[model samples]
Target: MTSSRSETAYQRAVAAFKNPTLDLLHRRYAPFVVSVLSVMFTAERPTVPISDAHVEVGTFVEELRAAGYDLDERTLPNGTGRDICRSWARVGWLVPQITDGVELYRLSAQAVGALEVAGRAGGGRAKVSRSRVRTLLESVEQLTQSAETDPALRLARLRDERAALDAEIALIEAAGDELDPIDDDQLLEDTENVLHLSRELPADFVRVAESINAMQRDVIAELRRDERPAGEVLREYLHRGEHVMEATPEGRAFAGALKLIGDPEHIDHLTDQLQALLGKSFAHLMTPEQRGELRAIAKRVEQGVQEVLQAQRRASHVITTQVRTHDPIRDREVDELLRSVMSGLQAWVPDSRAGDRIDPLRSLPTAGVRHLRQTVSDPRPPTAPAPLRDPGEQAEFVDADTRAWGGPNYAELEAYLAGLEAESFDLAAAFAGIGDAETRRPADLLGLLEIAHRNGLVESAEVSVVEALRPDGTARRFAFGAVTARTLKVESHD
Candidate 1:
């Protein structure tokens, strides 16, 4: 290679390694970061509530410290998990978001990329496997066939594929009763290849979503700046917003993925195939985590797609709304006023001294009124406070009686709910599972209802009864529509 070309290539390599994704992999605590992230985020969960994440991270730090890891302030951050997470956000490894008024932490595209790299390194697979080579060959052949302009060549290729299919079908029919299934080795190779490819989808989806977000922010910033004509800005942003999936290489890959598995049928087909694969004897060779990942692949893809779609919709909505509500004149006036104030401050700062005192205005300038009407009502007591009742006349009640009449035992109920392992269960069943008599009262039932509502439980149209015994030894059956609590899997660093 020429000297100039060599220099150019070296510069490009340097630039590539300098990105946040590579920086994350090259950091001193890379393994720690990647391992914690992998444990906290999974296919079933992509976002964690900030508070839970902070607490989990804090616990992990303390555990590690107890295990004698040097986590000094100089080597590793010494503050709480909240501080660590905040540092990550500042550095673009974690993105903090608010969904439905709850603060959540999501892995950034760069962090996702770093985690992918770490996962691939730990997978212990050869860089080039038989299945991977076969996939590449098939892809190249398909591409060549599609690119062929000559009718004769295309027809020949089609005829060859048809003949091969027919031969395979004939062979299968002839050996129907004595057919040999694929060996475990080949099945394992193919499954691993599928997993390697499937695992890449999350990173790609995150990258695409982040790209859309960046574009949205850029569009908004440009609009607020009022530097360009409204017509031009609107047209440009509208087109970009509508076709955001074509704007970047990652976006195009996302578009391709959407085309491949956008349909519910395609996703169902994928799930069915995974189930069939797991049913095979070769599946025993795979680890439990691998099997779980395969089972949840469809759900992961569906959720990822939904997230990207939501991001796109939000971007489009924000752009359209900004355009619709945009007032260029008002914006310009505000901008000018801010500039004037800043210019005055800049001019005054040079002549000002730190110790100089200035009068402070404590309140806003009053609006003067010439006439005022004063209205007053008679301060007489209304009906003499209904004569105080005698303490003797009040019904005597003990602590136990008051407790029975009080609200539900929310803390105890919450602890019970947390201890359950089921993904979902009927309200009646959960109530029945309570072993403590005090926890099975009517108040506890009401507490369960409140907890369920807070957790967004599903209510059924069919009625379900939960019988409760009060402290007074009286039993009462309360009838309400059935409710189901669907427990979400908590992603923790434990």
Candidate 2:
């Protein structure tokens, strides 16, 4: 007769989400909120404590400025950035954490859902990867019911799979029994799928941590309630929270992610295969910078996961301490003391202080609409807030890669090495010609040695000096030595 709990929940969720003003957040406050979150969520490690909040705000403002935001860092109110954090908290996208009377702010579980929606809705603006479909298919195949419980359905599915397998086997076992290996096209798609999944590891871990944090709060609240002894409640919720973290959907997903990141061999293999794939057919799919990111992604993902796991450990200790000293003796003592005090108060008498009051009820106004004082005052029109307008700046956010990829990579350096033909290598002169001075530090003299070793072209070498161009369009000189060509090789455009 009544709507189901889930349906009721859906209705409540819809009502809660249907706020006109709140919906405008993405438009009005998105530049600040999204940029900060973009960095906060994706940053390798962020500790935005109250101690650093002031400085962090200024740093973020500077970053935005570098990104061409026209807003003045100085003009921003002392408390302007903190207000956004508070606003997010009010909107349920952030949770303010407290530990031992200290406060910390973090993203709520819902924030991930919001970010995911934004990413799906073209906010990310990344190409719709070919790997997505493969990911979906693989997910379905892996997650489908197993043979243990749904034997009949499993049998049917297995039979269908067997049919497909048989077809493949037949093709392979035919006349010559030669099986066609997955070719470049399949390899491209497979590499993409792997990269896509690997890239998602950090974000997935962040969201899982968010979810676990939500559960931990719930557990703490349940344990702190006076309905039962604190120890019992704490113990119960601790076990439950641990189980949920270890066994539930988010937990399992996190565990799987951890497994992928935690295995050094797997990471090494993935990196090597990815590098190999990138140098081949998949090369065109990604930038040199992106390739670099994929190569180093495993360590970053592992660090994020470890941070989350460490947080869980800290939370466990916090919950234990919260209920460790709950004693029924102290509770009963307080209760009996309260009862005795109440009995004494009941038995004792007090002098009346009510004798001095005038007729309070009679002094009040009895008129419904008449005899009330009326006053009129001049009214002025409400003034709107001053419009904030600075033509938004357009400078780009620069990073190490921006500086590195600005000029060249090892490949380019090697090419430059081959291009030298004055009977010996000229490291500085070659790099100078290629405008790679600022890109590769002048102090990195070891690069010349590396190039020779890699190509096995150094039968002899010596330190030499030359000048190169800086990004500021100035020439700077450096000494990086030279190497003789051991093998006969010419500069190939390839």
Candidate 3:
């Protein structure tokens, strides 16, 4: 009797061959199927339970028909097309059975052996789907057609494909060019031919151009590092029949690489070479100032080198020394002495044509002192009398006793004299007393007469007493100098 498991397995196998999804499942399960068959065939009894076979087949198919393979849908095989069960049987992998009127199929022992052999050969898996094969074939055909019909596009594609060719060429050319002009270097010849071919060729030549240019740059950079003049390098490159200004990678790389290195010596040499070249190429191209500045920079560099050498010597000596003493006091003393000397020198130095001159007596008594001394020694000679223009203008001068005890409304003058009691009695006090009087007549007359009698305000009158009488009638001699307006001056002396 045919078991349900065997019947189910046959039906599943047939379905897998008919349906596209099932077909993908079959391909996925083929490895497992082969593995199981190998185990079965290796067994002396050569028998695999229908349930085990069915489980193995289902698991393998499910895995093979995963989303990764895009094999979800199933398309049924038509009547004339191949189906799973018939295909397996025809391939001698399975045999049909009719037991108890129930149809079933089982894997034949010979079929299992064949599967083992096929698995060993790594050919047990099914082939790819027909649709995918067809798509790939169609893509190849379209690509070929496009290449044939569109020349420009095809050339662009080629340029993209061979982008590095130019850079390589430029490198070879630049290196060959740098060698002392060779007679027949194949590399140089080849480079020239490549350049010429690239110019005429229809395919994109940018990549080839770039590569050659980069190679050229590398060559120039190497030469520069060896201390060759950049201009000389460039000139030699040009002499080899290459345009330095064109979009050649070599030329650009050479210039850029030189800039990157930035060696001062190389820059100086190159600058001079360039100037010379420019002079030859375009006479009167550079200004005199430009030339001068370049020379000056060179001179500065030489000076800097000398300075560096000297500094290095000093540094070496310092490094070798063992003594370490820091004397702040000594340093300060030296600084002070230096400062004094500088100050003295500055003092003696004439600031203008007038020479260093000193004021005659600016350091003498200040205004307050001089005023005090003058006030004490000689007060203003009363108020000086207005000149006696007319003899009639002269007012009669009266003695103190002759004058009224409470003099002519001189309250203000008396008050001023009272205030002067605290001050040093001198010319200023005398002047203040007389000037404050309500009656200027007597004061003015007295001041004029006193000035005339004493000859100067600062002079004192020497009074000699004939005799000093005692109350008992005994007498003695006396002498004194009175500081009065009698010793006054109308004008100050020089």
> Best TM-score goes to which candidate?
1
* Candidate 2 deviant stretches above 4 angstroms: 1-27, 40-43, 46-53, 62-108, 112-130, 142-204, 218-224, 246-248, 255-281, 325-494
Q: Which ten-residue region of model 3 has the weakest summed lDDT? A: 198-207
Q: Tens digits of per-residue lDDT for model 2 on 1-494? A: 99999999999988876643235344445546555665665434333454345356557866666776656553322345566566667776556666456666655545544544454453344445556776777677867754247778888888998999999777777836365555665665565456555654555566666666666777666654456656576677767766765766767778776676667677677667756766785467665645655666666666667757866876677667755755557766877888997886566535325554334445656567756568877586589678988642643665523443243355555655565566555444544565455445443335545665665654336776766544555666765446454322555576
Q: Whole-model lDDT for model 2 versus the true structure?
A: 0.59
The lDDT for every candidate, in the order shown, is 0.85, 0.59, 0.43
TM-score (C-alpha) between model 1 and the true structure = 0.70
lDDT (tens digit, per residue) of candidate 1 on 1-494: 45698899999999999988899888766776777789998877889999999998888878887887764543455789999889888887899987778999999989988988888889775557789999999999989998999999999989999999999999999998899988898888888888888888887899888888888898888889899987887788778877888878888998898999999899999889889989999999999978997888888898779889988887888888988999989998999989998997888889989996667769978989997879878799766678767674466776434655677887788888877898887899899889988889998998888887877798879999878988777888999999998653444476
Candidate order by lDDT, highest to lowest?
Answer: 1, 2, 3
Alpha carbon lDDT at 92, candidate 1: 77
Of 1 and 2, the candidate ranking higher by lDDT = 1
Name the candidate, 1 or 2, with the larger TM-score value.
1
Off by over 4 Å in 1: 1-6, 71-75, 125-127, 228-232, 320-330, 352-494
Q: After superposition, how far is residue 286 of candidate 1 from its true place, in Å?
A: 1.2
- Of 1 and 3, which scores higher on TM-score? 1
